[model samples]
Target: MLLVTGITGHTGKYFLKELINNKYQGVIRCVVRETSDTSLLDNSGLNIEKVVGNLNDKSFVEQIMPGVEAIMHIYNIHHSPVIVETAIKNKVKRAILVHTTGIYSNFKYASQEYKNVEQKVFELTKQKECPTKVTILRPTMIYGDICDSNMSKFIKMVDKLRVIPVINKGESLLQPVNARDLGKAFFNVLLSPTETSGKVYDLSGEKPIKMIEVFRIISKEFNRQTTFVSVPLSLGELLAKSIKIITLGRINYVEKVQRMGEDRSYSHINARNDFGYNPMSLEEGIRIEVKEYLEAKDIR
Candidate 1:
């Protein structure tokens, strides 16, 4: 039995579907909050055993840990470590920890709580001497049509707002990975036996390109005209910090976003080499994203 947390999220849906589509002959159970809205996952019915409970509930969760084989951990928050600790205590075979590449690029953009969660996971993994071999993956700037977050927000604004905020030639590097390349990743990691234990993989598409070029290609595809503004990197950071204050700390999203300028580019060869996990290029991804975004807007 492979237990998957965060099973209701975008990446989790794709991962679970991929597992079932490829015909993995194993029981796949999905963790969900008791109050979680299951309308989105209605398509992937009965196959997904919706384990209802919050991550905070340790005792009730422990009851279901008996027959568990391995766990695909798509969780990242601090409270989520409870699941891993329990998984380890229950002697689950393997754990695939889905982490973020913010540990590298734009790490400064991360809130103190985010990094704390990562550290706690690592520490718990070390302390338990847990029998479950743990593997970590860092996925950066993940996107698709359903998203209006991060770069997707910029993509949606291109046609509506003629002018866009572009920085320093608008060429910051981006390695946007599609959600589909996730199937083989978890399967392969589970197949690695013990070699994958305690290993962390930085996952991304093979090619990382400049953000300006990415926007330009998408703009041309959509017949959108966009004006660019040059904001100094330092000014961008200051603006972000100010937004954090002006919004009474509720709108610190820019504080984290502006940090994307630092080393946004990375090589996914490691992920490719490890589990044959290769993501599609930015062009192919954008083509799909823009098409969907346009179609959805038409219906709206």
Candidate 2:
């Protein structure tokens, strides 16, 4: 069985689809929390085995680890320690861990929660030869047809604000990989665990573009005359820190925005050489996101 954690997330749903569509030739088990949204899995005609429990639960994870051939651990929650322990204890053959560039970008600025979870992964992986091989995929900003990404968020904000905000004259660079490409990267990791083991693959788009240029794409796509208001990174950081405390449980949108407004691009040569992973260009990904956004708004 292929156990996929974070099965209800943005990329998780598509990960399930690729596994099913490619006829992975095994049972696809999804580890989900109590409040996880699994509606997308309904009527997908998949050989799915749903395992409902906190992946952070040592006992619960142990129960699911045994007899599983491979594990696609795609969560950033508090599940790393338990997952690593259970995988080793059960001698699970492979563990394809889906991490993000957040591990790098947010290394200094990341919330304690993200840091703890990330540090735990490295610590556990350092223990005992690790019965399972670990493939870590650090994906860049991801956008897709169903995405409400930074671009889409701005488009939505345009509905409210006559101006769009940019940090440091919108000079920060971003390279967004499409959801399908990200899903394919996950699938590719599974097929070539040895090549990817103990390696961090930074999956990115073909090119990195500036933030202001990105906003231009949004404006052109939505046909909005949204003005650009640039601010310094220091001010943005101050706002992010303040907002981080104010909105406790939310996704920390400010910190997330600040992270995006920072440049962190890398070579995909490793992904391509290791598993033939080729992502869509930023232009194409943007077009797809725009097309989907328009369709959803019924505006075109």
Candidate 3:
């Protein structure tokens, strides 16, 4: 049996779609929260078993690990240590984990926890007698459709407000991976466990582009004339803090502004060489996202 987690989330949903599209013949089981919406899984014609529980609970994880031969954990990286320990204890053979490139971020507040959790997982899997072969995939910022948390909000903001605020004139580079490409990567890794096991791969986009180019692409997609306003790094940080204080901590953009000035590009050459991984260009992916956004807007 194959076990999957985060089946209802942004990237997980795409991974599930890949499995369905390929007509996977294995029995698959997914762990989801009680409040998670399973309409997608229900509508899928694949045979899948749904278990309602949290991965943080040791007993709950143990109960589900008995017959699971391989686990595809698409959930938060923080839960990886627990899952790795339980999978090792249960003697599961192979495991695939979805992590992030954010662990390399210079932002201490956000990157510290990710680094710590990933460290624990690495230690567990590198033990002398460890039986499970674990492969880790670190994807860059994921954006594909309306469900994405990153570019979707940016798209909406650009559509509604034609003026974009930038720090350091938005020159920092970013390479975002589309959710569809990421899903296909997961499926490819699952198929080639021998080649991917005990290795880490960076799943990035076709190439890195400047933040200003991103804005221009979105504006071109919408066919709207947009204006770019530049803000000094220090002044932008001050305004972000002021906004947070004014909203009584409800809205926080301090880290968001800080990260905008940092480069977030990575290479997927190893992934391409190992698993034949290829991702779509940012322009093509953004076009799809903009289409989805416009269609949804028309519906409402």
**Cα error of candidate 3 at position 300, Å:** 0.8
lDDT of 3 by residue, 186-250 (tens): 99999998899989999999999998899899999999998999888889989999999999999
In order of appearance, the predictions have TM-scores of 0.88, 0.86, 0.97
Measured over all alpha carbons after superposition, the RMSD of each candidate to the real structure, in angstroms, is 2.6, 3.2, 1.2
**Index of the highest-lDDT prediction:** 3
Better of 2 and 3 by TM-score: 3
Best by TM-score: 3
Least well predicted 10-residue stretch by lDDT in candidate 1: 105-114
lDDT of 1 by residue, 212-277 (tens): 787787788778777777677778778877888899988775645466465566677766776677
Between prediction 1 and prediction 2, the one with superior TM-score is 1
lDDT-sorted candidate list, best first: 3, 2, 1
User: How many residue-pair clashes does candidate 1 contain?
Assistant: 0
Question: The CA-based lDDT of model 3 is what?
Answer: 0.91
Which runs in model 2 stand beyond 4 Å of their true positions? Answer: 33-40, 106-108, 111-119, 145-149, 237-261
Candidate 1 residue 262 Cα shift, in angstroms, is 1.1
- lDDT by residue for model 2 (1-300), tens: 888887778778778778768877778888877687777675667777888887545778778876788888877645666776688788888777776676667534654665676678778778867776666777777777655455567556655677877888888788777777888889878888678887778898888888788778767766778788888877877888777788884636566656656786777898899899888777777778777766877963
TM-score result, candidate 1 = 0.88
In angstroms, the error of model 3 at 154 is 1.6
